[model samples]
Structure formats: C-alpha cells, structure tokens
Target: MVVEKNVSLQRCNTFGIAARAQALVRVRSVADVQDVLADPRLARTPKFVLGGGSNIVLTGDVQALVLKVEIPGVRLVDETDKAWIVEAGAGESWHGLVAWTLQQGWPGLENLALIPGTVGAAPVQNIGAYGVELQDRFHSLDGIDLLTGEAFTLDAAQCAFGYRDSVFKHRAPEAQHGAPRGFGLAGRALITHVRLLLPKAWRPELGYLDLERKRAEASVEHPSAQQIFEWVCQVRRAKLPDPAVVGNAGSFFKNPTVSPEQCQDIIARDPKVVHYPLPDGTIKLAAGWLIDACGWKGKSVGKAGVYDRQALVLVNRGTPQASVSGGEVMTLARAIQTSVYERFGIRLEPEPVVV
Candidate 1:
C-alpha cells in the first residue's frame, strides 16, 4: 500500500495528455484495495480507480489518490451443457481476452475484437462494435465497494446495461426529470474480476454492413468464429487509427438515439444521413456522419484534430514531448458538439470519462 507522490500520467492515458497524480497506488489484488481502505490516511481520502487508461481524459493533475488496477488472470471457470463460463482479472487487456476465448474454442466474443482498455472497463462503458455489445455476453462481476470496503458481485440485470452506459458510469440514485431512474455506482465500486457467459451454440453476427462486405469478399456463406474475429479486426483497422500510432480515444461520441418523428425531421433536412433502426422503434444516428456532414473531418483546434478517416475520433496532433492537453481535446469536442447540435438539433454525448 505504498503511496507514490507526483506520479507522471502522460503515458498512462491513451490521449497522451500531460498530467500527474498527486498520489498513486498500484492495486495488484483485492487485498491491496482492502489495505488502502484499512489505512488511516488513505481510508478517508477520495480515491480514483484507473484501469487501462484507454477510456478517460485527464483534464489536469488528479488531486485524488489514484488506484491503478493491475490485477491479471484468465481461466475457464465453469462449463454447462448450454454455455462456457470464463473469468478474467480486471487488468487483462480486453483484446487479449477476446483472442484467448476464441483460441479456447469460445465464439461469442469474436465480434468485440480489438477494443481498447482492460476487461474491467468493458462493462463500465458497455463496449460494443460490429453489431455486438458487452452486455450480450456478460455473466457477472466481482468488486469491492469503495465506501464500505466490502466485496460484492452483480449479475447482468443489476448492471443496468444500456448503450455505452452502465451503473458503473453513474452516481447514486437521484431525482431526474421527476423520476428515480438515475441509479448508479460511479465512484463507489472497483471491479476485480469479470465472468463471461459464452453459449455453446454460437452464431455469426454479420448484421453490420462492413462485416457483410468482408464475408462477400471472402466468398464464405457461413463464417467461423475465427473468421468473424479476423473480419472485425480488418474492418476496425481500416477505419480506426491504432491508439499506439495515433494518440486518440476510439469513439468520441455515442450514437444518439431519437424518436421516429425526430428521425423524420433529420431525414427531411438531409436525406443522405446515415442511420440505423434499432429493435425498438428508436433510430440511432451515426454521429461521425453528422460531424463529417458539418465539415469537421480533417480539421483541427489547437493540437486536437478530428481524424481524417473517421470523424468520430478526435486525436492529438502533437508529439509526446509536447502532447495535447486535456483542455484542448475538450475544447475541440465542445466545438464539434455545438456544431452538430446546431445543424441536427441533437446533443452529442461524449463516450469517454473526462477526469
């Protein structure tokens, strides 16, 4: 439970924003978290749990004690006639977990290949790609309550999964629009392990147009799980810049869902607007398309720029020595949001947590 002071956080985050943690602790196990809670000084201090650093924007120096979760492990915990249960430690790379499951003959996670961040952050953001989401494969997770120092587990329903949202991303339940629907656990919990339920009877999810194009190119009527994984990787690589090469969070905004009438209004304005109708009656608009339509792609605000290939991704145009600051990123993001809203009458919600 050693606390390091003035720790440099430039490389810890995907955006490569220059910042430092006032105090930081490496949490390698559940006991480490308990120790921090038991300690007289840290117990009363506000803490920040960091995992993978892929889905966050550090605005400035973090004043709270940072708990860098580094726990690691993966195993097949249970196998029933219907499904295979796999458990992974919080610190394991999400992409690594996907590849591991596929290698072990598990097929349900193939559609989620190449997503950035740790396994624990997957449910926090409800990560999804290529017509599949983490909630579709989630089983359960174990975590320690930050407020009580007590360990607990939760099932899928308890997670309150939504589009790129979950209970982990919210605060305690509060009144909102005259309702009690804002139930959350935002900073109150730290996930240590995640369990996935992969059904034995797997089917390919080729609903996304890019994947269907890949299947057509390969001339395969029925693709295997491995094939689907490869296709997803290829499709993502073509559009998204690798975080290693370009300092950027994957998607900057969530695809906004709107009512049928709202969709019609947008359609009347721009008939070529890209969108998809969900299983429910709501229509999900492509945020990148809207941004591009507003002529934001290949544009820059200070050192923060929109990725030329994908308008939804905002990237750092500066070098590591003179990296883009979090403020620059947010300024650019706000500008994009304002323009999108002014043009489409839809407010764009950022996908990453702004710390």
Candidate 2:
C-alpha cells in the first residue's frame, strides 16, 4: 500500500468542492488496513474514512489521514428457499451492486436503483429510495476496528438501524473504559464487506407517488423488479442532476417526521402542506415543499445554490477552478435551515457529513 501527500479531493466528493487531503491512503484489502496500523508514525495519526464521497461536504483541507476505500468484489454467497444472500466488497459501487443482483435474478434491490455512493457508506446512512431502505435488504457486514485493529462482523440487529441512521454514524464512548448503550461504530470502524439478503418471493415496491404515476401511465397492473429499477433510474435522472455534470449531494436534508397532532396543526393553517403517514402513525413532511414554499429554490449564496429542479438538493454553481467552498455550502445550508425553521417551526437536518 502506498500513502500519498497533499492529494486534491475536489473530484473525490460529489459536490466537486475544492479541498485536499494532507495524507491519503487507498485501502484495497485487510492487509492494507493492517499495514496502516503497523506503521508507527502513520498509525498514530488521526484518520478519516472516505467511500464514494456522495454524502459529504468538504469545508477545508482534510488534516486527518484519509483512507479512500477502493476494495472490489460482487458475488452470491448463498441461496435458500427464503432468500438469496449476496456479498460485495465495501468499495463496490452501490448502484452497480443493485444492478448486479437483478442480473443474477435477485429482485429485492431494484427499488433503490441509481442512488450514489459506495456499499460501505450505504449502511452508515441506511440509504433509502423509492419506498426501499438499505436496512430492508441488509444481511450482515464485516468491519475492522480502527484503534484496536480487530476485525468483527455484525448482523442487522446489531446495526441499530433507524431512519437514515445506523450505529456506524454514532461515536462509540471513549475507549473500552465504557462503551455506550448503543454500539456506536462512527469513527472507530471501517466496513470491509457487506452481505444482502434478497427475498425469493418478489413483490413490487410502488408506494411512492412517482412510481404510481409511472405505473398508471404505462397501464401496467404488476411490475417486475427490473421494471421498477428502470423506472427509478428514469425518475431520478429527471429529478436529480448527475453529479459528474452538475456537482451536488442528492438530498440536502432528511424529510422531517412529526406527530400526527403537529401535522394537523400545520394542515389547519395551510391545507397545501404535503405529508405522508408512516406505518408508525407519525407524519413525514415534504422538506422540499417547505423549502420551495420559503423561496430557496434557485437561490445562491456564494456559488453554493439550492437546486432549482429539486429544492432538497444543494449544488455547486461555480466553475471547476472556482468551485464552492465548504464554508459557503454550510452557510447556504444554515440559512435554509433558519428560514425553514422560522416559516414552519421545523429545523431541517442536513444529510451530508460536513468535514
């Protein structure tokens, strides 16, 4: 494994923000991680794990040693009457894996097509799209403890999955001195591989409005998983800008969920409020609608602009040489948050990790 100094990270991130990693290492396998830990000087350095860079905003040059995960593999590990288990290396493209599974006749991951980022980062955010979440298909994952150099595996229950959250997103308590009530993996773990359990009995996930519309337009009563996958890709292409062309992190905020009473109160004041009733009876408000209502769409604060097409996305408006800074992005994000809070009494939580 080779470690490089002063590496530019402008292209590494989806936002294409201008920044650099002081020291960077491309981790491909378990041996590379072990080598990093074995080196005395490098081992002592603070570290940061980077996947596909689709869900982060780089505010400045990264000082921590960046481990750019690039491990690669995809295959079926097992199959049964109930489900087919598929395994992928952490650095494998998430969308690629979704497509591969369908090609192999595993139909469960079709609803989450076209979502950006790597497999390792998916569980961290518990990525969801088109009525499907990663946790729904997740089987297990293997990770290496950054500090102790110990390898471990965890099942779905051990992940503590929630709406756009997992143990990997939380900080573990300081040392073995005291682990938290939750198995917070956050900075302490580097995921190496992930296994997905795709169900044998396939059922279409057509709960989202767009999917329903597509189904209606096509006049199809029942759609296959591959069909859903194609529709999702088309819908996303129309709604979301390709990061390679126009720099952006897909959604800037999580759709805030509130109690039914709170939703009713808002509905009373404005009948036009868009909301969805969750299975748990909570109300999920449309964050994009709230932002659009507050007049943030197409607005820019120093090259960091809220996307005109989809208000939930934040984009880079400047040229490649003069890209958006992390501070500018945060400033725009904070302004949007403040405006949404003032107008709706709801604080919009940013989806991307600000570094």
Candidate 3:
C-alpha cells in the first residue's frame, strides 16, 4: 500500500472540487485494504473509502485517510439458457461494466447505461435510471470488516436498499459484526466486490415516457437489448450534462414522494404539476419540473449553475478555484427545498450524499 501525504483531490472527484486529504491510500485489493488499516496512523484518524467519486461533494479539506479503491475485474460465474450470474470488483467503473455486459449480450443493465460511478458504489445508492435499479439485478456483495479484517458476504435483503439508499447509509458506524448502513462507510464495513444475476432472455423496458415516445417515433419494431442501451446513452447525453466537461453529479435532488392527498392539493392548485402515482397510492412528483417551475432552471450563483435542460442537475461552469463553496451549495439546495416547500408544501431532498 502506498500512502501519500496532503494529496489534492480536485481530479479524484467528478465535480472537480478543490479539496485536500490528510493522507491518501490506493487499495487495489481487499488484502491491500487490510494492510493499510493496520497502519498506526490510520488507527488514530478517521478514514473515508472512495470509489469513482462521482456522487460526493467535498465541502472542505477531509481530515481523514481517503482510500481510493482501484480493484478491477469482471467475470461470469454461472450461465444457462435463461440467465447468468456475474461478479465484478467494487472498483470497476460502472459504465465499463455495463458496456461489457452488453457486449456479452446480457440485458438487465441496459436501462442504467451511462450512469457515472464505480460498481462498488452502485448498491450503496441503489443507482437507477430509466426504469431499472441496481437492486433489481443484485445477487450479493463481499464486504470486508474494517476492524477484524474478515470478509463477509451480504445478500440483497441484507443490503436493505430503498430508493437511492441502503443499509450502508443509516446504520451506526460502531456496529462491528453487522452489515453496513449509510454510504458504505461507517461501521466496520468496506465493499470489496459485487455479484449480479442478469437475464438471458433480454427484452427492452420502455417504461420511461420519453424513451417510449422516441422508440415509437423511430418505428423500432423490436429493439434488441444492446440497441436499447444505446438509446439510453444517447438520451442521457442529450439530457444530462457530462461531468467531464461541465462537472456535475447528475440529479442533485431526488423526487420527493408524498401522500395522495397532498398530490391532489398540489394538482388542484396547478393542474400541470407532473406526478406519477405509486402502487401504494402515494405520489412521486417530478423534482425537475418543480425546480423549473420555481424559475431556478439555468440559474447560476458564482460558478455553479443549474443545468438549463435538466433542472435536477447542478453544474460547475468555472474552475474549482472560482467555484462556489460547500456552504453555497448547501444554501442553494436549501433555497430549492424552501421554494418547493412553499409552493407545494413538499420538501425536496438531495440525492447526492453531501459531506
């Protein structure tokens, strides 16, 4: 394990925010992680496990050892005429895994193509797009106990995944022998690998209205799984700003779920309020529509601005040196929350884990 002192984290995070870490360690394997954890310096300080760094926003200098997971590889473990089970190292880039699966003719991940992040972080956030979520294909995950240095496998239920959240986010950090809760950090856990069960009988899921409209307009009689994957990529590219060029973690906020009565009241006030009815009779409102309706689309403060096309995304247009501070991002987020609350009496929560 190589440990570097006072590393600049501008490039490590997708947002390109300028931040410094007290110490940095790159872990390419579970053994490397264990070895690093044994270091006396780490034992005295906090440690942050990082993957692709696509979904996090650093507010200030991190006063901990940032472990960048670099483990890589993907493999097919079992296969039949109907389905296949595959496993991937947590450090593998998520989009790379999706492309590889498409090349191998696997279909379940097509809807999630182009989502930025590492495979290891996918289950923690239950990453989803179009109509598919990571939980829909999750088999299990191998996570290491930080204290005991032992590896444990957790099934899907143990993950406790729910709409962009998992056990990795909510559980207390001191639990030594249990599954991780809240953000894959905290507790004695570190995800080393993830297993996925994919379908062999691939079929296109045209659940998103815009995607369905595009397919209909194109007159695609029977789109293959790969073709659908390409379409999702194209649509995402057209809709979401690329973090490499514009710098953003797509969808800064999640669509808030509200009771049916609240949705009815909001709809009565503004008939155009976009919402979808949940199976349980609740309602999921369009967060982007809400933000745009509040006139925040294309708005900018300092170097950060809401994406003109997608109000749900906030982009960094200038250099990290010129960008807004963490406090500014929080202020803007709270403003959006307040605006949406005042208009519809529903609170909008951020999807990205703000640190």
Candidate 4:
C-alpha cells in the first residue's frame, strides 16, 4: 500500500473535479486493505472506498483516507447445468470484465456494456443500462468487515437490492457495524470480490427500443450475446460523452419513479412527457427530459454547465484560473430539482454519491 498526502483527485474522478484527498492509499490485494485498516493512524477517521471514481462527486477536499482498491483477477468458480458461476476481483474495471465475459460468450452481462466503475461497485448501485441490471446476474459477494477484520459472504437476498439501492445504502442504523453501510462504506465492509451467474442459454433481451432498431438495421434475426454487447457499446458511444474529453459521470440523476396516476396527470398537462411503465405498474419518468424541458440543457454557471446533448450530465468547462466550485454544482442540481418538482410534483434524486 502506497500512502500519499495532499494528493490531487482531479484525475481520479470521472467528473475531473479539482479536489484533494488528505491521504490516498492504493491497495492491490485484500491483505493490503487489512494492513491499512489496522494502521492505528487511520482508525477513527472517515474512509472512502473508491473504485473507478465514476459515480461520485468530490464536493470538497476529502477529509478521509481514500482507499483505491486495485486488486485484479477473474476466474470461473462453478459450472452447472443452469449457469456458469464466475467471480471477479472488486478492482477489475467493469467494462473490461464485460468485454471479457462477452469474449467467453456469456449471456447475462451483454446489455451492461460501457458502464463505468469496478466490479465491486456494480452491486453497490445495482448498475443498470438499457433494460438490464447487475442484480439480474449477481450470485454472491465476499466483503471484509471493517471492525473485526472478519470476512463474510452476502448472497443475493442478503444484498437486498432495489432500484439503484441495496443493503449497502439502507442498512439499519443500529446494525451499522455488522451490516453494509451507506455506499457500502460503513464500518469496514469492503467488497473484495463479486460472483455472477451467467446463463448457458443466450436469451438476448431486446427490450430497449433503440437497441432493437439497431439490430433491425443489422438484419440480425437472432442476435448473440456478443453482437448485443457490441450494439450496446455502439449506442452508448453515440449517446454518452466520453469522460476523458468531457468531465461527467454519465446520468447525474436516476429516472424518478412515480405512481401511474401521477404519470397520467403529468402527461395530461404535457403529453410529450417521456415515461415507461414499470413491472410494478408504476411509471418511470425520464429525468433528462424533465431537466431539458425546463430549458436547462446547454446552460452554464461559471465553470460547471449542463451538457448540450444530455441535460442530466453536468460538465466542467472552466480553466485553471476559473475553477468550478462545489457550490456551482449544488446550485445547478437544486435548480433542476426545483424545476422538476414544480412542474411534475416529482423530486429528482441525484444518482451520483454527492459528498
């Protein structure tokens, strides 16, 4: 473990925000994590487990020790008649893992291509794109308890995954020490590895209309998992801005879910309101459409601005002389929230973990 002080976190996060970490430690293995946690100097202080830094906003200089998990390895743990069980280290890049699985002709994770973050972080948010989510393939995960230095396995039900939330986000307040904490960083519950179950029968879920359109153009009668993966990558590349060029964390807000009656009322007011029916008969409204409808797209406040193509994306366009402030991001977010609430009586929730 290499611990450095006053490290700039600009390059660490996908948003490219200029923030500093008091102490930054890069751990290549679980042993390294245990060693760092045992170090008495960092025991009581707040700690942050950073993966690909894609789903976070460094509001200010992080006061905690930012532990960057870099452990890397993948393996086929079990193979049965139903599915192939595979496990990957928490540190492995998510997209890299998806590409590797597609190469092996894995069926389940094809629709999740191009998602930013690490394997461990996937389960944290139940990452979803197109019409699939991580929970669909999740088997179990091994997490190290922070306080006792003991390890435990969390099965699918144990994860308690919901839409963009899990036990990692909503653990009982009193059971903090033993259970996973908010953002899966309570009292040492670090994800060391994640196991996934992939199907032997490749059933391509062409539920998303855009993806289906692309497949139709290709004349693909029965798209293989690999082909669907490629198409997803293409769609993402076309729609989302590359964080390397434009500073962003993809969709900044989760599409707000509301009752069917509420959706009907909003649609009655403006029939163009984009929405989709959920499995529970509820309605999920497009947050981007809400934000854009308020005429916030291409709007800028100092260095931070809403992306021209996607209203949900907030970009940093300022130079070194005019650095963006946390206030600007908050101000913009609050404005969008206020507008959406006033218009549709729905409060938009930010997807990125805002500090």
Q: Which candidate is the best by lDDT?
A: 1
**Candidate 2: residue 325 Cα off by (Å):** 0.4
Minimal lDDT window, size 10, model 3? 179-188
- Candidate number with the higher lDDT (2 or 3): 2
- Candidate 2 wrong stretches, greater than 4 Å: 175-182
Worst 10 residues of 1 by lDDT: 174-183
TM-score of each: 0.97, 0.98, 0.94, 0.94
Candidate 2 lDDT, 79-141, residue by residue in tens: 999999999999999999999998988899988999999999999999999789999999999
The models' CA-based lDDT, in order, is: 0.94, 0.93, 0.84, 0.85
Q: Which pairs of residues collide in model 4? A: 146-188
A best-first ranking of the candidates according to their lDDT comes to 1, 2, 4, 3
State the weakest 10-residue window (summed lDDT) of model 4: 178-187
lDDT (Cα, 0-100) at 302 in candidate 2: 97
Among all windows of 10 consecutive residues in model 2, the one with the lowest summed lDDT is 174-183
Enumerate residue pairs that collide in model 3: 167-181, 167-182, 168-181, 168-182, 168-183, 169-181, 169-182, 169-183, 170-182, 173-187
Which structure is stronger by lDDT: 2 or 4? 2
CA-only RMSD, every prediction: 2.5, 1.4, 2.6, 2.4
Candidate 1 per-residue C-alpha lDDT over 1-355 given as tens digits, one digit per residue, 9 for 90 to 100: 7899999998888888899999999989999999999998999899999998998999999999999998999999999999999999999999999999999999999999999999989999999998899999999999998878999999999999999999998887657664334457898799999999999998999999999999999999999999999999998899999988999989999999999999999999899999999889999999999999999999999999999999999999999899999999999999999999999999999999999
